[model samples]
Target: MSNKVIKEPSNQLEYIISSKQEHEYSKAVNKLFDLALTYIEDAEKGNRLGRKAAWTQGVFEAPLFYACDTVPISAIDLGRLSSRNSVQIAEEAFDLPKETCSMISVLLGEWVLRNNSSVKRVVAFNNACEPFNMAYELIREQGYDVFRVEGAIRPKLNHDGRLDQVIKFLSGELGDLAVWLTGKQLDESRMAREIARMNRILAKVRTVMELRLKNSLYIKSLPTMFILMGSGHYFGKPDEFEAVLDELIDELNSSDVIPSPLGKVIPLTWIGARGLEFGVYKAVDDCGGALLSWFTPNPYDRNWREDVPPLESMARYILDYFLVGSPVHQIKGIERMIEQSSSKGIFFYHYVGCAFGGVHVEIFRDYFKKRGIPSIGLDGCFQVGAPSGQLLTRVRAFIEMFS
Candidate 1:
């Protein structure tokens, strides 16, 4: 055998959409990225906006395209910048929260700040809320221009009207320049595929640990050292995603099985609206945690279950959902995982200052605690920058406590 295991294809000339159980996604992010990739070749050939982003690189490329007189519309979703100048600049410019929005943005922010050299005017949107807005404030202050995209109504299933408005607003805001849409797509197929790839990758990683656990490499921990690239969007692309998934299989086959007694095994569930930050996921894993799955959608999220919009319907949905043993929201999943896993405690990384997440974290923590499940909450800008030693230190402590 040629030791060459082919995966899903990455050969589409334009953008590609892959499904997990294999459904088609043609909305919002999928459409936007498809549109962008349609122009990758032209961009790389050097358009007026300068180099259009080529698809052959790792994740999102820096020094992004900027046509003359047109500052591209971009979205940032991880990490943060810590500098006196940058911090002060953000405070003076907007009616923003200096204290709350400290130093955390998405992965794209850091990439743009470091790469796009000729970007004279830059605008960024912060739908992620709280610390994201705060982080934007700092980015604005630091000589890097950013605009905050206030959270509009988050749409539920059959709410194409809201998604339409979101897309329209983004397209409008993008203006005449080539728009850069970064982050997760709310496509069920794509999400499922991502979850599937994650499942496969984690299975490989867990295999080694399983061998150590049972002396037979039988049951594994799930994906541990997964490298789905491009802000973890590779998981969204059926082909490139499968590339990384296939890659993980090889890595698992060649590496040493982690011998146990593995102290404090952590099986986690992560949920972010667009998606969770991969950087935080990696750092958590580095500190000895197994991400069960980053479930961006709550069970009530139009994906796993139907989302009831109005309070009457929502309340009814909740009452009925739990009654049927299908926990309605994200909390239900956490509760279910703790009930199912071998983990000792739950760690909640509340996106440093995400408002919705802050509220959700508290809610989830409370729900789990009532069941006697221990959960730890941490503060930081997840992917916009390198996770400081402070984070690792905290994780170490958590793991030790697990032991």
Candidate 2:
């Protein structure tokens, strides 16, 4: 990573998008770190434009920060800045249980010694799972203002009133948070504009995803996905982020980009959490395999209804996503991705200590087998690295059986 001082962007969205440059993500990650560090400094000087709001996980909307004049950040995004050695050492130093997620342990361990004096608040959705909820309590005890969002009950997209109710519920919570943080009411108009821009970004992401599936552009596309997932919470300005997405979409759609020729290698669909462990999937791609689909909360799933309220739009987006609600809802999403990408096998990269994903791995593995889709369940930490040596051997053997 570069030691360059990260400058606050004249245009925040442009700056954020620039920090997540594809093919040079290490530099981007460095820039993001510097950005966070800068924010901390500003907060200390009482010169900050917005209060800091961090999601416990990656599920929350980033636009909420803009509406409330808060800096959006996530531990998951910052996880990219953590070295495997650092996380491993932190885990050992903390003496975390063997069953704990190293990624969470790393954050907890590091936070203990670090000065996060700039952070004033933390927000988490309840649906993130049990382990994360426990982690949130620890974060609260560290003196940050912590708030919990009782996330929507698994509501179907087709259910008319359910989504409306969910939106109303979250909107109330967000409105309260904005007022409490900034001493101003939530600017519905600003949120509407931001949500509109988010919708555009979502469209571009969907386009990239479709192109990726059509051409097996997984290797080229994951960085862009990461950008979308991280940029919103990284103090991203909306208009610039949209422009960046447009450029990314153009690059992905270019004729020079050739599809992967992994002929017999079974392309896998990643379920559960996507860790910051870089190059894991690319290693598989290099070994005659390809990643067909990498799932995350789908922002584009919302109905871009002009008449609908922005809060409702965000609610619809959150509720309609593949990761929301029940195990059955997620299973449907997984099966759809598998079919859409023409994947021959499923890789349940179950994060250790994630109860939800761990339990689903067995169910989905059996379900995939029953449906004639070969499945492999691999266990590792959230910041876990690429499959190598023995793990790589197992992945290759799994591929060989079907190939």
- lDDT, residue 14, model 1: 10
lDDT of 1 by residue, 167-245 (tens): 4554333232223323322233432343344345335333333332322121122122122122223322334434444
Stretches of candidate 2 exceeding 4 Å from the true structure:
1-56, 83-96, 155-167, 217-228, 231-240, 259-267, 298-306, 384-388
* lDDT tens per residue, model 2, 168-237: 8876776676676578887888888766666566676567667666555433424544554644453334
Instruction: State how far residue 370 of model 1 sits from its true place (Å).
Output: 1.7
Candidate 1 yields a Cα-based lDDT of 0.38
**lDDT scores in order:** 0.38, 0.58
Best by lDDT: 2
For candidate 2, the clash count comes to 1
- Superposed by TM-score, candidate 2 places the C-alpha of residue 250 at a distance from the truth, in angstroms, of 1.9
* Model 1 spans with C-alpha error above 4 angstroms: 1-97, 103-127, 130-232, 235-242, 253-256, 260-289, 295-328, 333-341, 351-353, 381-394
